[model samples]
Target: MKFRKKVDKVLGTSLAIIMGVMVINVLWQVFTRFVMGAPSSFTDELARYLMIWVGVLGAAYISGKRMHVAIDLLPSRLNKEGQTKLKTFVNWVIIIFCLAAFVIGGLRLVYITFTLRQSSPALQIPLAVVYSVIPVSGILIIYYKLSDIINKEL
Candidate 1:
């Protein structure tokens, strides 16, 4: 419980900070483009990259809170034991999907980008850096789901 709280706090704080930076970056971009009559080169790219981080991290945070959208009609009709079993099965499925599609796939993507020396045009940062959030969020989601399974009511 303590660890979960800590993770939640850190993830929340980090997301807030990233959002603040993104807002400031966009404001500066607008100021430069219209007010100053010249657009900043890096701000657009930075905002785009920051958006990726925000989206991916936000998904993880939502998953941790178990606030993701779900169609619960089937589960709602089940008995308590059936519900528990279904939830466990669903959680396991999520873990496997995240592992295969996010962690493994994301790492492969990052490796490829790094190998090719792919970088954003305006900021000249490696694409792998932007993509790193995939595996990170995958891990976070996996952790949350495992916690759910362990702490679940039987």
Candidate 2:
């Protein structure tokens, strides 16, 4: 649990870096696209990938911090106790789904990448790089969700 606390701190820092990078890269892309009339070949794709990491990694931090948006349209019916139960159930479901995709879907993606030897059109970067992020994010999300549940119970 102590180690997890440290990990949460590290992840929090990563969240900040990811956000800054995504924002800066997107702004630069916009500038280059509109002002220079020549967007960098890889900026768009890179920004997209960065956004993916930002979103996925941010999910973990948000989950850990209990910062995710939850609409309680029926707040009277779904009080805090109900919300807590629902969140726990949702987190469990998320853990299951994410683990499945990371283990099964990730392997398939890796296999496809190696088999086809596909790369990005502009950057010629290995396509596996993008797909690999999916599994990584899944793993992180699972870890964070479980940690949150455990910490909450404790």
Candidate 3:
């Protein structure tokens, strides 16, 4: 539980920092393009990469908070016990989906890019590194799901 709390804190801080960097990067890009009349090629690509990282990591943080988007019409209509059961079912579904699609699929993609030595066009950063966020987020979601189920918070 302490580890989970630490992970949540670190991730939250990281996401916040990434968001700040992204905003500044975008502002710099706009300023350069409009006023300086020359845009930085690296800034656009960097911002895009940062956005991807932030989005994926942020999703993991959101998972820990149980804030992912879902239609709650059925659960809302149900009683407390029913809602708890529904939440558990939904969490299991999400866990399975993340494991299969994100963890497995993302690892495969990361491997492929790594083997090929693929890099981003503008930033020249390894594609595998950029894509590694997928599995990380998936694992985080899995952790949160397990925690929720174990604690019976759902």
RMSD of each: 1.1, 3.2, 1.3
Report the number of clashing residue pairs per model. 0, 0, 0
List lDDT for all candidates, in order.
0.94, 0.78, 0.93
* Candidate 2, residue 130: how far the Cα is off, in Å: 1.5
| Candidate 1, residue 35: how far the Cα is off, in Å | 0.6
The count of backbone overlaps in candidate 1 is 0
- Displacement of the residue 108 alpha carbon in candidate 2, Å: 2.4
Clashing pairs in 2: none
Could you estimate the TM-score for every candidate?
A: 0.96, 0.74, 0.93
Scored against the true structure, residue 2 in model 2 reaches a CA lDDT of: 84
Off by over 4 Å in 3: none
Using lDDT as the measure, which candidate wins?
1
Off by over 4 Å in 2: 71-88, 152-154
lDDT of 3 by residue, 32-97 (tens): 999999998899899989999998999999989888788888998999999999899988999999
Model 2 lDDT tens row, 64-118: 6667787756554786888778878878987899888775688689679968999
